[model samples]
Target: MDHDIDVFAKNYIYQKSILLTKTAQRADWDREDVVSELTLHLLRRRDQFNPGRGSWTTFVKAVVNNRTTDLHHQLSRQRATLSLSDPRVSRVAERLEDIERLRHHGVSIDPESDQCDRTIDLNNVLSQIPQRDRRLCDQLSRFRTADAAKHLNQCRSNIYRRIVSLRKEFSSAGLTDYWK
Candidate 1:
């Protein structure tokens, strides 16, 4: 009887994951990842499923709904954090560089203007560094050094080197104290 219940539970978990994935049908949510998360969740909570309180299918459905909601929330939070690395920043930065080039060719820009002034401080500082270094700096600011290293697929020492390089660039641009 126990073996039968175990097989039934596993089958239900897989079926629920397939239903959720089909409803989503987006590339962001891998079917396997969702299935594995649901599987782990059920395994951990197996003792909580009581046949006396509810039908087995009802209990399984509740677990499926809860796990799917959690997965959606986790993906949403990840997207929110990743929005900082959007391409819009690079596009705006490129336009700012064009304005700087015009200034270099003797076209005087009004430094007091809001548009130009917005690019004068930290944006300018970040624009001066290589793209990889800029991303490294951003990651380091948001996460611990070890975490940043793991995210970038680099060693801790490499992360530290990039941090030193970023600090030097910021110091040269008079934005050293801004980050703290």
Candidate 2:
């Protein structure tokens, strides 16, 4: 409650909240909830307001419009899980029944072959690195550059040169994207 919201700001929030709920059409999103969220956002950002830059009403309208649209877009990207009928259920059942009749067996799918291969390749590459340089690699994986240097009792510039060396080794091993 940095300052009281003027009548104009209250009106803007009310109007925008209705529009937001109608546009989202989400059962979870009531008009009052949207209004509260918008009001809270305006209040939280009040410290950013500069009176010399603009009018109060203009600031209210701008903040309401931007925040309302932001909430709407966020709500749009989220959806309930597929708890209802699934189109592939019948097809999968039929395939399973055929397999059971023919050989009394079920199916197993491994969708992680590529991931497994990459992990194994990375480990192989890491094993070939010497112990001294390997500590930097291990530390860098757990922390940012500065923190990694601190953990290894080295300076930032030393950490940078070690990083360049590691990157070069990784590049030659054909796992260049792994560092990033």
RMSD each, Å: 18.3, 19.2
Worst 10-residue lDDT window, candidate 1:
76-85
Clash count, predicted structure 1: 0
lDDT for each residue of candidate 2 in 45-72, tens digit (9 for 90 to 100): 8877878899778888888999998999
Tens-digit lDDT track for model 1 on 41-122?
Answer: 8766667877879876777678867988877666655643223345777766676786787688776667567545544656
Worst 10 residues of 2 by lDDT: 102-111
Which stretches in model 1 have alpha-carbon errors above 4 Å? 1-31, 74-79, 83-86, 108-180
Q: Pull out the clashing pairs in model 2.
A: none
Give the winner by lDDT: 2
Query: Each candidate's TM vs. the true structure?
Result: 0.39, 0.44
Q: Give the TM-score of candidate 1.
A: 0.39
Query: Model 2 residue 93 lDDT?
Result: 60
Model 1: colliding residue pairs: none
